[model samples]
Target chain A: MAFNILIVDDSKTIRSVIKKTLEIAEIPVGELYEAENGQAGLAVLQENWIDIVFADINMPVMTGIEMIEKMNADNLLEKTPVIIVSTEGSQTRVEELIKKGVRAFIRKPISPETLRNVVNEVMGDYDEGGN
Target chain B: MKEETKDIVYKVCCDVFEHLAFMFGEVLDEDDITSVADTFIKASMSFKGEQQSGIVAIVVPEELSVNLAYEILGLEKSEQIDPDGPEDAVKEVLNTICGRLLPAIFGDSPIFDLTPPETTVISYQEWEELVQGHAYISLEIENNPVLITTSL
Candidate 1:
């Protein structure tokens, strides 16, 4: 099944890049939703059949960490897969994200390969490598 | 700028532009940097982390900001600029730079919280206030002037 993914970042350029990168990685995306920040991202979650989320840690209105924390609190979307796609480099921050139930964290300047591998890791046997 | 800070800034600026923006840049001597281009857009953000707390800013020429929006978005070059697109791109590139820069300098054990980058129109005077008194590192992105400053 093709996955429906959501990207949350304040930068339109970054959202566009992530969409482009997903196509380049050959990850079959059923639909792609873009949100400017965590608040908007949470709203997208409510309105779509999103399978995964790729979020930037720093964003206006709401940060990625806050979004994930909210998700964790909501029983409905709590188990949804979340991968942090951010420029955040601090080890301590990474630990905090992991503690909040983030499935993976990928740094900025992310390549097609990194996106593909992380997606595969999250999806388990549903590997894009086979596709 | 301290030699250590300059080195970190230079490396981060180079990496962020080349990889994220698909643009190549090299840090130049402050004397070598010039503000001949008048119209500009500036993006500034603050970072709080284990060892450092400072402001990071990136200023780019007016036209270049629009050009970069397309470049980073993987869109074909166009004559018209999407008003919000250019400013968003400029701000994001700086945010990405700080995000990448922090990990490189502080190691992963420490954490940093970065403010969302803000982009604005500015006169050369405001730009000078930030760039002055430091051996600021400047670059030519696609031959257009770009300045990056970090105050700790």
Candidate 2:
């Protein structure tokens, strides 16, 4: 089964690159939704059934952590895995996110293989038949 | 900062260009980037943390940014890239570099909040004057001149 994914980041360029990376990684994708900031991301979440969320930590209107906090509060959306795709590299911050229920963290300048592996681990394989 | 620390900054700049832009670059010895080029775009970002607070900036040549956008977007030659693609590319690249550089220099414990990148189009004359007294390193990417700077 293919996965419907949402990417939240302020930079259009970064968002585009991520969509391309998933394609390059050959992950089966059902639908791809994008939002510029965390507030917009929450709206997307409410409207669509997203399997996974890839978000950046720093944004103007709302930060990724804030969005995650809201999601954790919502019982309906709490189970959806959130993978932080950010420039944040501090161990302390990363630990905080993990403690708050983030599934994984992938730093900036992310690679295709790394993205694929993390997604597969969190959402299960898209192809289903193969690893 | 020591001379070696500056070298690490240059190395990190090279890594970002190579990894994100899929291009290679070498550091240049120059005080002013404007003296070397006429038209370019600049992107800057700031980071605030307990250990340090500073800014990082990158100036890229117009044509190189176009090539980088095309590479990053993975579009065919026939598909035209966006008009502001170059500026946005520089900004994103700056964002990536700043995120990586902080951890590389200060270890993994410092938690910093980064600001989204802000980009501008400026002439060499403006760039040369704007970067005065800043600690910076210039690089050559695909025979095009680019400059990276840091201020603490």
List chain A TM-scores, every candidate, in order: 0.93, 0.93
Query: Whole-model lDDT, candidate 2?
Result: 0.84
Candidate 1, residues A60-113, lDDT tens digits: the string is 789999999899999878878899998887778788888888989998877999
Residue A118 of candidate 2: its Cα lDDT?
A: 98
Residue A65 of candidate 2: its Cα lDDT? 96
CA shift of A127, model 1, Å: 10
Which stretches of model 1 miss by more than 4 angstroms?
A: A125-131, B79-81, B125-135
Q: Indicate which candidate wins on DockQ.
A: 2
Question: Candidate 2, residues A4-43: lDDT per residue as tens digits?
Answer: 9999998888898999899999999999999999999999
lDDT string, candidate 1, B32-61, tens digits: 666666678989899886577988888898
What is the alpha-carbon RMSD of candidate 1 to the true structure?
3.0
> Which ranges in model 2 have alpha carbons more than 4 Å from their true place?
A125-131, B31-37, B130-134
Clashing pairs in 2: none
Q: Number of the top candidate by lDDT? A: 2
